[model samples]
Target: MIFMEDVQQSQATIAMPIDRVGVKGLRLPIVVRDRESGVQHTVAQVSMSVDLPAEFKGTHMSRFVEALEHWEGTLDYHSFLTLLDDIVDRLQARSAHLRFVFPYFLRRRSPVSKAGGMMDYTCRVDGYLKDGKLTFTLGADVPVMTVCPCSKAISDEGAHSQRAEVRILTRFEGFLWLEDLIEIGERAGSCQVYSLLKREDEKYVTETAFAHPTFVEDVVREAAKGLDEHPKVTWYKVEVESFESIHNHSAFAVIESDG
Candidate 1:
């Protein structure tokens, strides 16, 4: 075959730069360190992008996966940032972005039954690098039981309760884990949930949520308070959404601060 010119390297007449451009929704197995568990292996949906200069027509899409391979099966805060920076340098771009969304499993035992199982939390790690500075964000979605305080107070027999999730977003200067955010979220809800629960455990959780009787607003406020006090968190946002069992709509609240 005749040697062909590198089409992607050819100069563009329009010279329009893109803010972000590269691969997304890539499923790949990654190894991440867990503070308590030591190591975790999970598949992540990844998006890696680099700012395209006006001179360039396109970025080398395959380079994103090639960069991930350099991870050598492990990624932590330092390595994650380094990867983003390396991409920026390799692509000769002004900035780069990387995002990994995965299910992080946490082990939990039933409140009363003592049965144990793993529950997966929606977790995300995102990094953006520019001018030797890196801004990384850690996020998690934790599901728990929520009982409406208003329904509890008004109802004669029992209160309407449903599953709710607290999503926490944080920008930290130091190491942070999805597990830490999971704890904060679980505590803010009326009661924690378990993947495997016996009848006894179910009974306990039901009564516990009823006794707590928290609204979506309350959950967000409580989660925000916890994040605000976190020493490592430089900024934080907490959002709570409760699927109302009695109503057609869900209740939600959000709180944020720059710590």
Candidate 2:
């Protein structure tokens, strides 16, 4: 037999570089610091990616999982920045991005009875680094009760009340808490929605919403104003969706920096 090892070595070719590579939809249990409270336990769906240079063949995918394992439960504004820095350093890339979506719970007292309960809210965080510059965004989807202003003004007896979801996306340089966005959305709506409510609480919510009817246009505008006043946020987008009780379709509106 001729030299088979020498022939195999000569035939080996280098692999091509991948533009973007990392993990996606990784379900990880984590502890995130809450601004109001100290810490909260949550399950986060995380995605990480890095750009590969032309010279490199492929990035070590296992390293990304290792980095995430180091800070699995310890997540905060500073911790997230550190994680991004570590990923960029380990991957040896010009850019790296991380995204995390989780459900956060907040305790709220009923308006009438003052009974407290936990309300769950959906929240998201994104961090990216490019050319030595880093950017971060925090987002939240808050549910509230909305009564139509036009319906209230036009109807004689009872106005239409419906559930509304407000999504707020913001780019922040400093610490931007998810609770802040939730509060803004709740206040902008006709009334804040609760998971558990008694008879008195229900009556109180009905009256409160009746007194503060708002249109889809009003909801977005108010949320935009609140975001504008936040010092840490440089850019923001506010979107509101109202599930109309009278009609089958929902009313929606969006406001952003460009608008």
Candidate 3:
């Protein structure tokens, strides 16, 4: 005769919540709409994240990469929203966030001779979703030539000229291309900078900027005006930074979104 002993089992315990979990600095190729042209191909550095509830100890890190792989080709407002929604659903989380930064090139025509060239602009897009509600933001860093107004006023011979970068961030209610923000920044500066410039083009840029000298503060205000008039943009922030030629420090100005 044989006998068997009874076994005891332990009770299950719940795990603690993670504050934030996701991926970062993921490089991928993407295509975006070019205002002058129809489409442009570029690479983007992307980041995605989601909030973890108090009941969950961790999130599935692999899921974020998997989601990105699916929609990494053609990126747009609609595709971005769909990706965010998928992340939220797949992770079973209340919120999801996405960020992408890329270099966008635009073909530009010379003011005088109408010579054509390409200018590269740094652009970024961010999206977030919570409780099925979504919000999207677009941004760009534009480089231009800024001739100091005060320098021009005080100096008799020549005014101080420096390279300035203007950054524009805006929340969009509808579709808006990165090129739009770039144009706003270019118009705000004394003159827009270019990647390739011949002697004639350089002369035109210098004279044009000297004729329309601007301060850092002026650039921010002007950029704000352009953003205000745009119908697709719901909110915006304009920032200008000039690399001072005389001094080591740079002059900067910022304007936040009120409308």
* Residue-wise C-alpha lDDT for candidate 3, range 1-259, written one tens digit per residue: 6865321112214544555679999999999887767889999999999987655546778889888877757778889999998898877789999999999987777776677887888899899898888888889999989999899999989999999999999997767878788889999999998776778888999999999999999999999999999999989988899999999899999999876
Model 1 lDDT, full chain set: 0.88
Q: Candidate 1 on 1-259: residue-level lDDT in tens?
A: 9998877888987899899999998888988878777999999999999988889888888788888877665667888878887788677788999999998987889988788899999999888888888888999999989988888888799988999999999998767777789999999999999999999998999989898999898999999988887788889988899998888999899998956
> Whole-model lDDT, candidate 3?
0.86
- Listed in order, each prediction's TM-score against the native is 0.94, 0.85, 0.88
Error of 1 at 119 (Å): 0.9
lDDT of 1 at 124: 90
**Which pairs clash in the backbone of model 1?**
none
In terms of lDDT, the poorest run of 10 residues in model 3 is 4-13
Q: Can you write out model 2's per-residue Cα lDDT over 36-96, one digit (the tens) per residue?
A: 7888999999999998755554567877888898874677777888888889888777889
Clashing pairs in 3: none
Give the better candidate number (1 or 2) by TM-score. 1
Question: Per-residue lDDT for 77 in model 2?
Answer: 71
> Best TM-score goes to which candidate?
1
Q: Return the candidate ranking by lDDT, descending.
A: 1, 3, 2
> Which lDDT values do the candidates have, in the order given?
0.88, 0.85, 0.86
